[model samples]
Target: MARLGPLLGALVKIRWRTLLGRGSAEITGEVLMLLAAGLMAERFLQYLPEFPVVWVWVGLAVCWLGMSRGPEGVPGQFPLTRGDRMVVRTVELAVNPLSWILVFVTGRISGWGLCLILLAGVEWPTWRRGKRVSARPSRWPALLRKDLRAAVRLFDTALAGVIVLMFVAYAVREANLAVEAAWIVPVVVALSNSTIALNAFGTDNGTGFDRYLLLPLTGREILWSKTVSLVVLVGGQLGLVALAASWRLGWEMGLVVGVEGLSLLFLLAGWGAWVSVWVPFALKAYRFADGGSVWAGLVAFALCLGPGMAAARGDWWVRLLVLWVAGAGCWVMLGVAGRRLERGRERIRERLP
Candidate 1:
């Protein structure tokens, strides 16, 4: 046993020496990270005397980062492994003065706080594990439908009922002129329904089933399903909004806004679908190496807001016309892109490599 212990200790010492001599770059990087962390902690702690509310904000910020990042590697070519991240965070918690200071200032000794601290510092093992793409190409439609059902099921029934009641209460309180009040419902509906278009593809983070690729459904079929789903979702929201507007704005104003809002819903939903398809194509075409497509989507989203805002402000006829035109344009673009994708499937697959 003593002989085995000496051998194990020697191995450990050798490994440590090897890691220590890996490179000056690694050492520099560690130094920079420690310095930056220290500066941030100092700044946060210094502000506590003047701003008591800042602690919660800091906690929230830390929690958000921990939740979102969860143990990913550093942003470089030689990114830290998940285990490395865990070790680093553990060391920081033990040795860093700021960790103690943060604990002291926050007074968060509960299990949740410990969880957050661990999450903030621990390297999640799932990160950077090359994703396994299922090579099945025959079951995309069922897969998408499953996700669609899941999306619908995910909404809280009680929360939605509460939202409805709140809308009614607000309408009753705010209604003065029926025409003006009627517009509010449709606008709310349009905006809320627009959430259905969130980056469905990106949500999977490359690990989840590539449902579209697995199914025999063409891009057109997928687009159609998405469009239909959006129409139903938007229509439901529009109906609710129209009811609310009618309560506050008069029947005529409600009708006008309802129609306009429905049109806007179609336009926004269509555009969102179109962007989703186009983004993947653009990423493939440009051969963007990282998360550049997310940035591109953000830019597109920002640009789309202009038409939405304009349509929201006008009378029923004007809003309807604007939304109709916008919707038509988006539909046309989607059709063109869908056709292009369908025709260029082989080329796209080739580009992916």
Candidate 2:
């Protein structure tokens, strides 16, 4: 226990070296995060002049949250312990003058403020526990499994979890009241991921796209792999939202929304196949951008989102018929896009790495 201070200091130095090695990939997002925190802190300090005691407690809570992230390592990975909690945020705690100012301000805190010091700065050891993963890949299709893994690495699950929480809160607040707002869920999902689906091959670069061409599968099969993966990934988000709808609206409403959302996903995926062939662009690793061709993107959105928009106004039975029609039309679109894909293989390759 006497060596704890030295251990923390050593860990911070080690973390700095690790940051210098792999920070480039994460620096963009992390810097933006710091800027936002700085802005909030500036406003907080301005307010502190009037109600110094109240804001001091708030500052302590903020610091505690900054340190209280999930276990340092992922599930099924190596573990990081109490002494190893050093991260970029920990670096900020030491190096940032604002942190010390908060500390200095906190020292002036007399009664309850002093009690919080033990809770705020002291690292709790139990927080290091992580879930054990039962990773059974054979249960999932190859393409879907790959896409799911990519989604996890990209933190898409975090975004979906946040959206699901929002829906849950809305449902709980309107516990007895029900509305025909299920259609809005699909609309939000589509708009959020429209450009991502359209540029499906962009992240792969030439090497990954070439690997697809080299496979024994036909062009249509390659398109199927890409398109189906997008549906499965995006559909997971829709499924969670629909489950929340069931709790608030009713099971019947949940079924209607799920079916409607699946139809929208199919139509959008078909449109995405065409866009992938027409306006494919290479992307730097670990980044996202608009699909590069605004005209193509707008056209895709217009064609694909109609079913979802119409679902809001139509009857449930009418939507069932529309789903069948959509699935058929999407199949046809995919077939044509696959043919064009083969013809434009060289052109697509030129746009990638």
Candidate 3:
């Protein structure tokens, strides 16, 4: 038992570094997750009625999602001794997001907590592996399906956006506080996604952008495909979040958040097309972003940050105005990106090839 403490601490440190290495945007997303967890914990303690089933599942969800979502290297690359396994499991349980819920519930219902702990304790690799794969082709084909597949290439980034959306929903639900700053969520999402959004061409290990060239689409058409992909990525997460928030926060908040998210999506998709043409790079999952041009960062700020900051003090209607203006910009930018993509086809091939 005494020897196990040191081993557990060492593995925990390794896990932390691996997570931190994913770069600032990714880290910020994680920190926000903890914050959302903490906020919801307060809400749960105060208002929600207790059901044993609810308590058990909520507790189990904390560690299960953590173990699944967080990358922990290739399974069994290095042997884990008995003590090593014990330590690794302990640390994973300890640092999981929304961990406060698990602790408080355990104190209230020790039996359920123990069972949940035992269930989550067993070895399970990353979450994506546990996902149930679809058997049939999608009913929706063409660009929608294409976009959906591209978004899956780095679904972790989309999950980060989900965290942001959930956090914003809960934050607004807090009593005696204002929800005037809905744009913050979309802004954070845009910046967090900069790793991919900035380099749209490199979504799937330098291969995601290849499918576009296969089609006889023009540059505007190519950019439109990527934009649809972004829409699916952001929109799907937002939908799930709104459903969850609707359960606790009112449905009104969901509508408000939808407006906010759509506003930013227009700006993001429009400007992201330009970034893809002018400042593209390849993306690798679960690692620090290696390459991006200055234009990428500047475009993100000008497109997302500017509108977000302007609407900080106003309510959802202000964001709607920003949405209308961004829609116009999106139209114009799409044209510009298409023209550039058409002219620079060979050059883009040289760089991306």
Best by TM-score: 2
Write the residue-wise lDDT of candidate 3 on 217-319 in tens digits. Answer: 8888777767777777776665554454444446776665566567677877777777778766665543334556766677677777755665565566676
lDDT (10s digit) by residue, model 1, range 1-353: 23334433544454356446636764564355335434434433333343433433344334323332222233223345555444544543344333444555455434356545544543343443576855556444545554454334322211222233344544554535335334443443343333345333433333332445566766766666666665665566667756777666668656665566566666666666665555542211101112325554454455345444554576556666676776787678567756765765554443232
- Point out where model 2 deviates above 4 Å: 1-140, 152-161, 176-180, 283-286
Please, what is the TM-score per model? Answer: 0.45, 0.61, 0.59
Query: Which 10-residue window of candidate 3 scores lowest in summed lDDT?
Result: 44-53
**Model 3, C-alpha of 5: deviation from truth (Å):** 25
Shift in Å, residue 169, candidate 2: 3.4
lDDT of all predictions, in order shown?
A: 0.47, 0.60, 0.59
- Relative to the true structure, candidate 3 reaches a TM of 0.59
In candidate 1 the C-alpha lDDT for residue 66 amounts to: 32
RMSD of each: 12.3, 9.4, 7.3
Task: Point out the higher-scoring one by lDDT: 1 or 3.
Answer: 3
How do the candidates rank by TM-score, highest first? 2, 3, 1
Q: For model 1, what is the alpha-carbon lDDT of residue 149?
A: 49
Ranking by lDDT: 2, 3, 1
Off by over 4 Å in 3: 1-159, 165-173, 238-257, 288-290, 314-321, 349-353
